[model samples]
Target chain A: MLEKGTTAPDFQLNATPDQKIKLSDFKGKNVILAFYPADWSPVCGDQMALYNEMLKYFSKHDAQMIGISVDSAWCHNAFQQDRKLHFPLLADFEPKGEVSKAYGVYDDEVGESKRALYVIDQEGKIAWSYLSPTAVNPGADGILNALEELEKK
Target chain B: MSTLKPEVSSSDHIEGSDAASITIVEFGDYQCPHCAHAYPIIKEIEQAFGDQIRFVFRHFPLQESHEFAFPAALAAEAAAMQGKFWEMHDALFENQYRLSDDLFEELAETIGLDVEQFQKAILEDAVKQKVEDDFESGVRSGVNGTPSFYVNETKFDGGPDELFEMLKESAE
Candidate 1:
């Protein structure tokens, strides 16, 4: 996995069937890249739901969150609508796992992104990163803490 | 290995003895069925332990998926302002199947709160901030889901039944 201090490699992924989002477009703002295994997990430990609730807090830190998965754009659209997720769930599909691989978080054996998180600073440097246990949600604190530290600089 | 961050303090909404031997803190979402399941078991645990256990409830609403979660939490916070948090919390869990703004107001009336103030409190920024703060603390404390429990400050990675068995074994 890529470590902190490396430049956050940029990628363009489908946010919806007709929309594409490029990571480089968010240059001046902090970004939170949440690389998860998939969407529509059970509700009890639903990571996406947890992040949805934290959107305001992340906005307070001036950070934009994006969830990346190997799922198709249509799948992401359905998941977002069903969950009412406000953030973009970028489809790392078509060239499946291409973006995930660039970030060095692609699970080759499983053919999905590992449950990972990255706090990309406004300058596009990786401020911090964490590889969470696949089953755990890896909640908002790490991203918040990283954003806080960036503010100190 | 998870531990409670920002330890339970006087500012916290505590429902049991301060000097209790065990402190069980729950980070819960009012709209989550899993949390609703833990609700009765939590009551049973408190009853079984009495003064031996101190209980605390913190909001960790997953508002994205559960539309009524934030409102439910705000209802609890508003009820707290009127010294009726437990009453409101219990009412919410008991009526989890019918959670809505109207239900919150009705619950407030049933609990004998100043209904007008409770209604206004639900929209207050402070009330929302309180819930948000609790959620932040839960996140920092490694709470990944509703009804995440901390026993004596350590995360209890088990269900209500397992927690009950553990507490029961300790008391024996």
Candidate 2:
């Protein structure tokens, strides 16, 4: 529901290592904000793995990819450990659906987040956002392509 | 025997071989209850078909709704690194609701992974990225839901009986 070029909503959530990650912290860098439903699904695993493989590309582009989910920090920690993930997965667990709602990825009917990807520019403006139905999966290349296009600006 | 390969992304490769003439590619989430429901049906089909068919699973975690799905996927991948992927995969689905951190660790221990190394691997950003890439691939291929299947590149629009019939046709 969020449009491109709109200001990304501000957020402060717990990330891995029991630290807090704030949206404003990356004020001068591009951020690939991905919202996924849960931790241990088939498509989600592949999706996160794709990003892990492309970590270098994101870094080369001076971008940070952060995944958001409603799982607890401990769950994220376990997930990160298990997958050898190279990115941070934030814990949006305390308020349960606050961050997801702010991002408009929350599925109120199911009490879970929708599959949505948001590309936030260095200035904290949303450069791109994609929302897929609960049953479909979203692409990492599309995100990379969007970032590439945004960098041309 | 017929062999069908599901479309794969540059980041992933399917490496199993069975003499089955039919191949089924499942775009599923471990966290989605619906997928969990389909799990047994897939198992039944596999048991019934055995070497006659091959089943491939692709990651399509709906991170929006099921909070534990993605991380649980990573855990399965980590277990896979130890050559215990299928074991871990089965365990995850069997214990879907208890996907807390403590539970993950317990599961790792139960599976005999080096707890310290396993923990380190899961926290590594690289691991999460791999899962992310899989997700991106799913989106690219127009997968919008869990338990979506492509039988020989033809989407499965029917239920279990329908899927079984398709499998039979593909085998022929």
Candidate 3:
């Protein structure tokens, strides 16, 4: 997985059928990249729902979060609309799991992304990262703590 | 692995013992069905634990999904000013399926809150801010979803059934 202080690799992924988000575009803003296995899984559903409720907190810290998964933009659109997700869920499809692999969080054996989190600083350097057990909904404490540390510096 | 960031404070709407060793804080959305499902179970836990537990409810509305959530939270906070927070809180969860924008005012009346005062309170900044602040605290405390629980300040990563079972086992 990506480590703190590493310059996060840039990528272009689909946010919606017509909208593409570039990692480099968020250079001046802190970004939370949450790479998970798939959409519609029970744990991922809860994790996204939890983050959906937390968009304001992320915004308060001047941070934007984008969820990355192998799910297609169409799938993400349906899931986001159905779940009422406020943030974007980028599709790491096309070349499936490309972004997840760039972040070194791809699970080759499982054919899915490992549940991972990366808090990238304003300069695009990873400020913090964590690898969570697949079934565990690794909540937002780590991400908030990293944001707090960034503000302190 | 996470703990409640700011800890339970005087502003929290609390039920049960002040001297309780087990304090369970729930960050819940009034319109979330999962929260509604856990509602009876929560009441059961309070009954089972009795004076041994302090139950605190904090607002964490997902306004995007549940449009009535934030308004419901506002209603509860407005009721809090009239010392009927729990009464309005119960009315919300009990009628979660029928939640709507107009439901808050009706609930306020049902709970015996001064109807005119309740209507005015929801329009007040302090009442709205209280719910928003609770949401911030919940986010900082690692809350990821409705019905998220923190027991004695530590996040409990389980469902209500698992939570009650843990408490039951620990009390033994």
Runs of candidate 3 with Cα error greater than 4 angstroms are A42-45
* TM-score for the A-chain in each candidate structure: 0.97, 0.93, 0.96
Return model 2's CA RMSD, one decimal.
10.3
Q: How do the residues B1-115 of candidate 3 rate in per-residue lDDT, one tens digit apiece?
A: 8889788888889999899999999999888888888899999999998999999999988777678899999999999999999999999999888988878888887878899
* Interface CA RMSD, all predictions: 1.9, 7.1, 2.7
Model 3 - which docking category?
medium
Query: Cα miss at B96, model 1 (Å)?
Result: 1.1
Q: TM-score for all predictions?
A: 0.91, 0.51, 0.93
Q: How close is each model in CA RMSD to the real structure?
A: 2.2, 10.3, 1.9
Q: Judged by lDDT relative to the true structure, which candidate is superior, 1 or 2?
A: 1
Off by over 4 Å in 2: A42-45, B1-172
In terms of lDDT, the best-performing candidate is 1
Extract clashing residue pairs from model 1: none
Q: Ranking by DockQ, best first? A: 3, 1, 2
